[model samples]
Target: MLLGYLLEIVKDRDKAEEHLVSIFETIPQHIDRITGDGVNTWCELQRLARTYLAGTMYADTTSEAKFPNTANKFSALMNDEQHAVFCSIYYYGKTTAQLAQELGKTEDLIRKALREAFAIIRKAS
Candidate 1:
C-alpha cells in the first residue's frame, strides 16, 4: 500500500520500490517509538511513510513540481483544516511538532488534524 502511494507521487517504479524497501528497513528501528499502547499500527506506518516521502519527494528543492497540487480534485475533497494539516506535513515537509509550534496548537491537536486529513483522503479514494 505504501509502495503504491509512493508510486503515484514519485512516478517511477524503481524509485518507488527502492523507497518501499528503505521504509521496511527503517521500520524496525522506529517500531518501538511509533507503535505504543492502543496506537493503530497501520496508521502509524502510514504516518511514517508520509514523513519519509515528504523528505524524498522534496529533495530536489529547485524543482517547481509538487505532489498534491491545490487544483487537484483530491485536494478539493479536503476541508480547510485537513488541507492545512496535509499540505504543511506532506508538501512543506513540516513535522507535527513544527506545525504545532507554527500554528500555536498542541502536538496532539496537530496529530488529530493529520489523522482527520488522512481519513478524508481515504474517504475520497
Candidate 2:
C-alpha cells in the first residue's frame, strides 16, 4: 500500500528518497504520541501519516521548480493543436485515444501531436 502511494506521489527516485527521509524522521514522534491510546489510535496514526507524507512529497517536489524559461520558449513554438494535445496528455492525464476523441481527431493524429510537442520541448531543453 505504502509503495503504491509513494509511486503516485513521487515522480522520480531522488524525490522519493527525500520524502522517505522526512517521513521516517517524523514517524517515531507520531507513534509515541498515540502509544497509550491503544491499537486503534496507533493504526489511525500510521494511516494518517502515510497519506500525509504522500501529499507532502508531491507538493514539495512540484512546487520547488517553476517552469524554466526554456519551457516558455517551447510553448511559444508549439501550435494550438500541439498545445492542446500536450496539455491533454500531461495535465489532464488523457490517453491518446481519449484525447483524439475529444479533439475530433484520429488516435494516430493525437499520437503525432504528442510526438511533435515532445520533440520541440526536448530541443528547447
Specify the highest-TM-score model's number: 1
lDDT of 2 by residue, 19-93 (tens): 556766676776765566455764555455455653552332222132122224666788878877765454334
- Clashing residue pair totals per candidate (backbone < 3 A): 0, 0
lDDT of every predicted structure (CA atoms): 0.72, 0.59
Clashing pairs for model 1 are: none
Summing lDDT over every window of 10 consecutive residues in candidate 1, give the lowest-scoring window: 59-68
Mark the regions of model 2 whose C-alpha exceeds 4 Å error after superposition.
1-71
Q: Report the Cα lDDT for candidate 1.
A: 0.72
- Looking at model 2, the pairs that clash are none
lDDT (Cα, 0-100) at 53 in candidate 1: 71
Off by over 4 Å in 1: 54-65, 69-74, 78-85, 95-125
